[model samples]
Target: MALGGGTFTTMNKILPGTYINFVSAPRASAALSDRGIAAMPAEFDWGPEGAVFAVESGEFEKRSLELFGYPYTHEKLKGLRDLFRNIRKGYFYRLNTGGEPAKNDFATALHPGTRGNSLRIVIEAAEASTEETPVYDVSTWMDDTRIDLQTVKTAAQLHDNAFVRFQAEATLAATAGANLTGGTDGAAGDAAYQTFLDQIEPYTFHALGCLSDKPAVKALFTAFTKRMRDESGVKFQTVLHRYGQADYEGVISVENGLTGAADDTSAVWWTTGAQAGCAVNKSLTNRVYDGEFEIDTRYTQAQLEEGIQSGGFLLHRVGDETRVLTDINTFVSATEERSSDFGSNQTIRVLDQIGNDIAALFNTKYNGQVPNDAAGRVSLWNDIVRHHQQLQTLRAIQTFEPENVTVEAGDTKKSVVVTDRVTPVNAMEQLYMVCVVA
Candidate 1:
């Protein structure tokens, strides 16, 4: 029999050369994860179809044309621009894929949408090439701006650019320019939004945005969020418009919408990003709205207070600037398991951070690697305490006690039971100062 050199699970083998298991106990493994990510499922006239793509803030400005099929300043990207103002990274899904891609004799547009119709290809004869082996200069343009330039001897030598894919079998020809045509956007229905929700489930984001104003669509997003947060342990908040009936900590209901030409759009996009980008120790209450939308903020003081009682996340004009009325979610009813403090978004963020961080610490440091022994349980307890100390120092949580956390073997040998408690901190939202007459 061959010598058993691999790691041992039960240590029962008779003939074993070396049965060793490697486990990591790095201190850095328990560090808290960053939280500036958001997810959005929206209809785009142009972009990838049937996929979730990540867009980084650092590259959104430079790669706007390539990624979204529009320039950075285009009106089509106004909502995304507002969203990106706060978030660092976003996972976006283009919910429409029912259109035909534009195509010409030389190449086809990379994606389907009306924007592809603006793509044009220009081919010119190079100066230093023989008639038998002619060289050509190809320029890819979106209207007046040339996006890609290539020099090729034949169609076979051309490769796909950002805007279009080359036709390797077509003969090269020189003309003014060939514009891509016949691009169309397929209609986006409920099924498309469902597809987006199904695909975006695996991603970890702090906030999700529902841009649709339809009640049914909002309800779909609301249900999906509750299932993910309650059943799957995925911690995040979903921002919706005019749907306070969700009444869940995982949902933020935007009561006020904007007017003007962008009536369909609302502050939900900005709030989604803001809620995601907000630090766990901070709050968005009274935060000024610095977005591009002309928000509807004509509510009176009584209306604002009433909206808060109804768990409405609304905005109102304070002086000349619009500010958030309250940083809260649609969590009106309190249960035995949850209290009114859960309505505060800052409190929610801290709780979410602790849950996510401790889970990460356990999964990365102790899961499957550490044996279910007293020593292993103690090691896990220490790491959890250290992580909580960091949170306490950061003011995300207050007065964390290491003795409050307990780790023990679960009902089975493969299971580890951990019980932890955290008191999340909330920012001040009210003032009750009185003046004494002298």
Candidate 2:
């Protein structure tokens, strides 16, 4: 039935059901440190009705599935309904493995039934601003959150295991005084040489670097660090774009950061955000907007050699090793193959309890006790059957409508002209009440 000329909204709700996890054979590895991996559990969050509500803003959050309100058996109904919906959205279907037309199908060389189904239908639902607000009952701000064609994995593991690094170089233009030779236009040039010597006098005699020579090394290292930072930024941005396009959004945290080292005349000074022997450059770690991000090691052979050769470098082994692991939650197509066909044939035995009622009516109304003889009883049974069939046929005819066809209307603005006409009632010799013709 179609309702006309108004915004028609439907609220489909699926009642919640208990969820169970089955691990047929559970196993764990001792060598995998203290960390462990587990499969993402399947969930069912049905609302008041049979419709499955989308998960919002929590651990599972956007990583939930959506289902229709109708109670569908695994085989006959759910798949068929999904197929029909796809067809309505212009997705031409082909037969799948079990000989049913599927929306997500392609004819591959090896398996001619597989295809990439990317067509989507965007529904405008209302999102809840708070827990008290009813989301399913509204019609604005809600977006589709289900991930498609991706596998699920945990992001916490990735944050722990991913590598990261940081480095920086000097801004020489801002640093104070080295040689300002080109600034002055002096005579003979000896005075300029003398001025240079005076400027170098402050630290020229020091064991490592005169204060004047320090700027050169700082500038080089700073530039190098800046380049590394830029590269890291680009790589992270690319990952964010890809994940967002795939409909995955989450926070990314990097651990164990690296701040660039400084080179001195006698040794290299690696900036340690933490104290000596603690993790260095830890503050470089940050919470990123993408689902995945990385941390890395930053070092240069030339810088290391320069520090070692100058007797400032100390050789010490890294006593502790921190392992990193990464995980991601992606959406992938899964089938619930509990039974090839889920529906069963039901036999509905509807015995008529109308015998007494019919007999009584006949006895009272027709002034008959209802004959008890075999032939008479047989005739009564036939009469009952005839009445039942007539009522059924009348009902069917009342409810069923033939396909519509266009017809001309002479004067009426609205009229229903059914092509298959019903017999008109003849009133010429019918009940005659006292009446006057206008």
lDDT of each: 0.89, 0.20
Candidate 1 lDDT tens digits, 347-400: 899889988888777778787899889998998888888888888889888878
Backbone clash count for every predicted candidate, in the order shown: 0, 36
Over the full model, what C-alpha lDDT does candidate 1 score relative to the true structure? Answer: 0.89
Model 2 poorest 10 in a row by lDDT: 343-352
List runs of model 1 lying over 4 Å from the truth: 1-28, 129-133, 261-263
- What are the per-model C-alpha RMSD values against the true structure? 3.9, 41.3
Tens digits of lDDT, candidate 2, 203-296: 1110011111223432332232234224321100001101111211111111122223132111111111001111111111121211111222
Task: State which candidate has the highest lDDT.
Answer: 1
Superposed model 2: Cα runs more than 4 Å off: 1-123, 127-272, 275-315, 318-438
Report the C-alpha displacement of residue 375, candidate 1, in angstroms: 1.3
The positional error of residue 337 in candidate 1, measured at the CA in angstroms, is: 3.2
